[model samples]
Target: MIKIVVDLLGADKPQTELVLGAIRAISENKDLYVYLMGRKAELEDFLANVTYDESQLEIVDCTQEITNYDDPVDAYHDKTDSSLIKGLKMCRMNEDIGGFVTCGATGVVLISSILILGKLNATRPALSVVLNGRNDKPFCIVDCGANIDCKADRFVDFARLGVAYMKTLGIENPTVATLSNGIEAGKGSDVIKEAHELLEKCGFNFTGNIEGKEVLDGNADVVVCDGFAGNVLLKSIEGTAKVVFDDIRRAAAGASDTQKAQLEAFIGRLEPKFDYNNEGGAILLGVKKPVVKGHGAATDKTVYNTVKIAYGLAKNNLVEKISEEFEKK
Candidate 1:
């Protein structure tokens, strides 16, 4: 069975929907088990009336909650009983537990995971997200937020992790492209220039430099950059998606019922491409185990999909395979 740890404190209310989603996940996946990490009393009271197999859903009480205000370092040492820390510790110590799902503070989780579980095939763990490409295929971006001030060599490590990550999803020979101001090999800053040389000559299937506009054109499966740039790119893409989608909703508001129906159908097709809920969340690639960073404002649907992602990752044994692949080298 592929075991997953799902943090229950991300939701705003009494966690009714979150608990329901957890129950649904286990009920659907026969061999799946979820470790719901939260307060001892909270979960007890929460799950008391809920209909679910107690055996299938285990609770690990972690009362202290980590907030964005909490310093990563302080929270790491002080908030040992916090759900974020406890969950990471669980994934680190238990081999049966293959993945962790959390919508907690990104800084705290990333720092704690690296300190507790250590790195797999990377210098420091990176935030990796699979974005839907224009051609309907998904591409990955390593170092989306973790490790902001990365070195040229760190970008190389990101490339390696990105390649193995895509391969795990059954994509062989995934293309690698360095994001630059221009498509020319000599385009970007000194760091990009140096990294470009290393990627081209360092046994990677490098497709040369790619401009910003070409990123969504599906020219590459992995667009590598420093965390600063990568994170900016990610937020921009997210904002654009929200604007575009929200605009569609506004346009449909005053339309006729027929037009609204047509728009809804079209939106249903477009949601899988732009919805964070459908995509689950970003993965902390290069960690010792599977760790997913869920959106803070996630709904029950989003929570279910994120946990499903963890289950899928564990079932596929991707983290173990990546660790073995790095060890062989």
Candidate 2:
């Protein structure tokens, strides 16, 4: 059985949401075991409202709840009983535990995972967000919000990690590209230019420089960038999708019945391909164990999908594969 530690008190929604999600996951997989960590009484109260098999779910008592405003590093130092910290400790204590999933502050989750679990090799753990492409393939953008300033070597490591993830997801030779202003070889800032050069010689299937406009054009399998640039690009894509959909809705509001139907269909077809919440926040790669940092406002469905992702990572031995790649380097 696979044991997963969940931060039951982490989300902004009612505790019932987490409870329902856990119950749903448990019902889906009979062999999966859940160790729900949070205040005992609150968890128990939530449990009282649901009817689930007692054998599949177990509650781990933790009194303190990590708030959104709390500094991540400070919370790790001060709140020893914080659910996020406690969940990581639980994973460390038990070799049987396969992964840890948390729908809390991203900063706190990253700090706690590093502090408790440490890095897999000498490489720093990076936050990798999966972006959906046009060809039904998901490309990973490393350092999505982790290390803002990165060196060429770090970007190379991100390539290896991204390739490993692609393999785990059944993509054999994932194409890599460096994000830049133009597709030309010498088109980016000093950092990107250096990264592009290094990637060309790195023995991976690199496709050269990719511009922001062509990110979702299915041109590259993995797009590498510094956290600052990656974050800006991610936000821009999401923001543009929102604006386009909002305008579509407004235009459809005053259309004739037939035109409104067509507009609605178009809007439905153009909706953002990737659901960030549905896939959890992002995977913290280059760690010894699988750790997922979920969005603070994630709903129960998002939390459940994160658990599935963690399970897949553990089952595929993703971190171990990354270790092997680093050793080869």
Candidate 3:
């Protein structure tokens, strides 16, 4: 069975909601086993009301919860028993455990992952997520929100991480591109220029620079950037998608019967494709194990998809492939 550790606390949503997501996952995949880590009473009370395979689930007792307000460094030492810390420990100690899932504060999760599981072959971990391009093909964005200040070499590292990730998804020899303001090779800052040169020589199907507007045009299989810029781009795209959909919904509400039916059908066809909840969370790559981080405001659907993605990562040997790629350096 593919075993996974899920930290049920520290999210903006209620613990019971995440628990329901996990149960949903277990119900669909019988070969999977989940170790749900959170308050024992709450877990037990919630599970008592649900119908699931008791043999496939385990409740880990955790007394403390890590909050966004806690100092990440201090919480590392103090909140050892918290769900976030304990879940990392479980991943580090057990070889059978495939991966971990959490909706904790990003800072604390980063710190604990480094301090506990450590880095693989001295490479820093990058947050990577696969987003669909205009042609409906998927492309990966590395360092979505992990490293705010990155060196030019870190861009190369993110590319390598993205390559490993895409390969795991069954895309062989994925093309890589550096995100820049303009498409020309010399259009970006010093970091982009240096990274672009390095990517060309470092190999792995390095394409030329890609502008922000071209990101979703299926121009490249992997787009690499620093966390600061990547985070802004990600949120902007998400906000824009939400606003556009809301406007469509509002228009549909006031439209004539025929127009409303057409608009509603149009939305029904496209809305799920852009829904963040269905995408689950971004995978933290370059670490010792796969760690998926979901949004703080995640709901039951988010957790269910996150668990499924985490399971795929573990089953596909994502961490081992990443380690092999870095070890070649």
Candidate 4:
């Protein structure tokens, strides 16, 4: 059986909703055994009301939870019993535990992952998320808001991490590219220029630099960038997609019935591609174990998807594969 630890605190959504997601996950995957860490009485009450296999679920009693208001560093040091901290600790202590899933504060998750799980050969962990590109193929971007000021060498590390992740998704010999202002090799800053050269000789299928617009065009299977640029790029794409979709919705509201039907059909087909709930969550690669960070506003459906991803990565031995790749360096 594949075991996963899920922290049910520190999200914008209520605990009950996240718990429901976990229940859904276990119901779907009979081989999955989830350790749900959160308030004990509440969790018990909620579970009692639901009909699920008792063997697949275990609730760890946690009195405290890490919140956005708490300093991530201080919370890590102080909130040892918090759901996020305890859940990760559980993952570390148990070899059978495949991975961890949490809709917790990103800062705390990143810190706890490094401090608790440690890194794969001490390489920096990059947060990566898969997105459906314009060409209808899925692509992943590394360092999406973790390690904001990465050095040039770190970009290369991100590329390897991204490649390792994509390979697990069955993308053999995935093409890689650096996110920059222009497609030219000299388009970005000194870091990009230097990293560009390193990536060329890194032995992966490097496709040179890709502009922000080219990212959605699926120019590369993996796009590498510092956290600052990556985070901005991710949010920009989300924001743009939201604005455009909202405008279409407004226009459809007043359109003829036939036009409305066509617009609704278009949105139904396109929206899931950009939805965070469906994409599961961002995977924190480079850690010793798979750590999935769900969006703060995640729903039960999001939790289910995130747990599925964590389970899949753990089953695939993502950490060991990544370590093997880095050992070649």
Judged by TM-score, which candidate is best? 4
- Tens digit per residue, CA lDDT, model 2, 113-165: 89898888778888887778776667888778788999888889888888887
For model 3 the TM-score comes to 0.96
Q: What residue pairs are clashing in model 4?
A: none
Candidate 1 lDDT for residue 305 = 79
lDDT of each: 0.80, 0.81, 0.86, 0.90
Considering every candidate listed, which one attains the maximal lDDT? Answer: 4
Q: Candidate 2, after superposition: displacement of residue 222 in Å?
A: 1.4
Worst 10 residues of 1 by lDDT: 10-19
Model 2: pairs clashing at backbone N, Cα or C within 3 Å: none
Question: Model 4, residue 34: displacement in angstroms?
Answer: 0.3
Candidate 3 C-alpha lDDT tens digits along 1-329: 99999999999988898899999999999998999999989889988989999999999999999999999999989998999999999999998998899988989998898888888767888888788879688888888888888888998889888888888888888999999999889979898899888888886698889988888787888899998888887777777888999887886786799888887787767765565546788888888888888888888888888899889888888887787667656
Candidate 4 residue-wise lDDT at 327: 79
Q: Which stretches of candidate 2 lie over 4 Å from their true place?
A: 256-266, 269-272
lDDT of 4 by residue, 18-42 (tens): 8999999999999999999999898
Q: Name the candidate, 1 or 3, with the larger TM-score value.
A: 3
As a whole number from 0 to 100, the lDDT of residue 244 in candidate 4 is 88
What TM-score, over all chains together, does every model reach? 0.92, 0.93, 0.96, 0.97
Residue pairs that clash (backbone atoms under 3 angstroms), model 3:
none
